[model samples]
Target: MATSYRVGIVGCGSIAQRHTKAYQSVPGFHLAAATEPNTETSRAFQETFAIPKMYADPIEMLQKESLDVVSICTWHGLHAPQTLMAAEHGARAVLCEKPMAVSLDEADQMIAACQASGTKLAIGHQRRFYPGWTEARRLISEGAVGKPTMVTGYVVDGLLNTGSHVIDGMRYVLGDPQPEWVMGAVERKTNRWERDVPIEDCCLGLTNFAGGAQALLQVDLTAYSSADHFTVQGSEGLLMVAPDSLRLISPDNSNGETLPTLWDTHTQSAAGSVGFESYFHIAYTAQAQGLRAWLDGEAGYRSEGTQTRHSVEIMMALYQSVREGEVMRLPLEEGAYPLSAMVAENKLPLRYPEKYDIRDPQRRTWIHREAYDRMRADGLSHPEIMATLFNK
Candidate 1:
């Protein structure tokens, strides 16, 4: 019989629920506990999911439960600390939420803790597990697109908050090439919320990768629709993927005849069209499967922690560029700039809903203060953070 891995989840927030559902759908895994700081929320999560245990504190749950793996579903800032704690608790592996940490340093600490503890860590870049993305990566790796030259990613939201997915997804499809440098601009057009939050509403970044492939990313919260758009341009063809469809164009015709080029004569006609055979909203499901495979010692399973760390490094570089008002080189060194500097300099803006005030320390500190402190204490300095987070 295949051994059933015991799993515990920390943070009973919205995403945690999704993780619970995914676990339930997979075999050879058991959802042992769900923990949250708030007793009410924890209890509610337990009741809603029929989980066997619920704890008000994640640390307590980690110490008490005989879990083989723990899911760090806390706020964006708590990912690293909770993951470190999980590693220390003898868990075989940990699955953390995105962005890994607010700062590069924190991300490093989490990775180091896992490494030291002999526990595996996987970051939740669930989109990579999606069928469309999986297919796209397959095609790219098989040279379907032929030496990708450039990629354009548009994620209509803040860079740190939501842009991490776009950035990570880019790395996933591009074969995790080392970044050369980042040049970007950020904008915060509206301030309709509370004062203390430190997030940006829109950003545009240009990056050069080691393979000479250039990437352009645009993120905006003010976009007209709630859809994502991505395009990859290769030497021979172009590929476009969106929320609803995926299209591939290459330069060869079935009859071996040169096809008519549109727009630019230099562009060659491409071939091949593949669509989603079975329409399934399985992003979260695939993530769960990947997590299980990693814990089961399945070869070739990409750990989530690795992806999260890289995403953190890329975003940090972009943020650094925006702050310094110059192109920031890759592999940022330690103590480059404190998270406090980013907040104090007003380089990182907070974009909240109309109901919340950005100025409230408690409210604004979710992504900045709380997350940074946990990361810093874990022994991750800026450069170290970038190295670990971005290291492929």
Candidate 2:
């Protein structure tokens, strides 16, 4: 008989909705309980998902439920503490969202706690499961694009929220190399803060891998509708990876001798990279698959805690590089929230959203502040607070 794992969700936010739907698609996983600090939101989530139990605190949920897995889909700052609580309370595994934590110290603490309690922790860099990305990795490993030398990704959002995907994606395609150093610069001209974490209007960085490979990251808020492209350059060919598409350009073999040219291109359609295929819900399903594999003692499952920590370390190193105006080395020696420190110092420039079609700046600011205060008072989840402000 197959074992069905009991699952507990820590936050009843927008992401939790996606996770619920994905869990419905996965076999041997039951959505037993959930936690949301806000009363109304928690009730709504419970009703929507048909969750059997709901609580106002995750620790309470952990204490009362015999959950085999706990998904910590909380704010950026709460991931570590909540994960620790979950591990201590006997969760066999935990799935957390990206950016891992705001600082390395917190990330280390989460790793240590999970290790101490024998809990398998997985960060939600589930895009690695996309067929397009996995195929790219396979092709790279197969030497289709011989000796990958450089990689690049263009994104349109904050580092932690959107940029982390690019970083993780690049890492995935490159076979997860050890990062040597990173040099970065950030422009903070916006009031783009996710909960308490500050977001940059534009951030660019170059990360050097141990074996002379390099990855370039360009995240600009101005490119609001950018296609979000990830490309790899190798000694023999070039490959471009997108959500719905994958393109490879290599030598053309035709009449007589074979010759490489720019005119020859091969495109692949990854049907799995479409709507729910490439987006939110499918990712959680992929996560479930990885979890099941690990539980079954399958080899080569990629969501281990150590690898996720490397991704988080790369993120933190980029921020540290931007702040110090120099190349930052890997395995950060110190732990601090560099972005938060910059925000506290008022080092970031105030953005004029009114010029960007956000008219009535005063009223909007007041409303956002009021909503934020409400969230703090009611202990609302991060997604709910964001929804209240943006009317989402």
Candidate 3:
């Protein structure tokens, strides 16, 4: 093998910047090239990172760059086609951002393309690399929580945004059990979009895992949004989990047990891991390190596509449940995104009528990015962030 491998980035947004820093932190990965259609954004990204080549055309970059690793950091709808393109271009591995794709069909296409091309496909559920999460998984499996019967995961934004992590995290702690069925509800009173894809205004559902445990999913269902959390209720105890923190509460102790975060567990070893940021910076590095080992012939990568496909299916099935007006079973028969279909059929007409994107600077409803960053650094949850924004 070569001493180092070439890595290309498909987008130059904030997430892509993080991915660039992570690739730089990990050994044996070089930031060889990148493509961004937005000229100003691409220039800013290139200014911050030392990527040698830039392309306005993604296809041009894919054709010209002999990249071994490709990071697909585009919008939700672009994931599958971009992933298939990367695979077709001989990239050995791809770490595409979450929600994977708009529908199970696109997800299937990505999985099949990668499988056929012999490329390692990993979905960006990097929270799987969180130390607290892994610890919770170990404890749950060893019965520390004892006979987990129910798990409740909550997130804001849309189901495909932070909700994907919530679903994947809940399953991860419970040892990635199979979800058998789901009954869901959604409210889309207006035309709402997240990162250029249609999304429900709010949604909630109950999914029965094949492992005798049930999970309640809440996505944008409340005004009080927090860091997406997974609370597991076992026979012996209850556990509350976030990407960076874990809490264990047993029968005798109401105070609960505090668990290690990256800050707690790897202070000495990971001083250098926080290259561009802290907190999640460590998690991203760990994920990249895991990817490195997996690419070097490890048995499994935690967020592989086939595994992530189940989570996507669960979400899709949830939407389908609302679309069909009944509970939905797994292996969803619907190939298109149900939410988008509803929008297309005018099943969800804009009651308020103006379109808005919560992440867009031009959109006033979206929290200001600077304030969002500042509050997050101050340890504010999503609920607090929104409350603060609304109070003003």
Count of backbone clashes for each model? 27, 0, 1
Report the C-alpha displacement of residue 258, candidate 3, in angstroms: 2.3
Clash list (residue pairs), candidate 3? 225-383
Expressed as tens digits, the lDDT of each residue in 362-388 for candidate 1 is 554434445444654575532232224
Instruction: Encode model 2's per-residue lDDT on 1-392: one tens digit a residue.
Output: 23888999988887787677667666778999999988999989988899999998787889889899898888777898998999999888898887788888898999999899989888877777666677788788898778999998876546777787888888888999999988888776545565456666568878998877799887762333223358888887788875445678777421222222221011112113335434444556667777866766676468677787776788788888877778898767758877767767766655433212122243345446665666645755333444455553
Candidate 2 versus the native: TM-score? 0.82
Please list the C-alpha lDDT of all candidates, in the order they appear. Answer: 0.67, 0.73, 0.83
Best by TM-score: 3
| TM-scores of all predicted structures | 0.78, 0.82, 0.90
The regions of model 3 sitting more than 4 angstroms off are 261-277, 363-392
**Winner of 1 and 2 under TM-score:** 2
- In model 1, which runs have C-alpha deviations exceeding 4 angstroms? 189-197, 221-228, 242-245, 253-281, 334-340, 346-392
Model 3 Cα lDDT, one tens digit per residue, 155-268: 778888988888888888899999899898888865567888878777898888887888888876554554446789999999988767789999876799887765445322
Sort order, lDDT high to low:
3, 2, 1
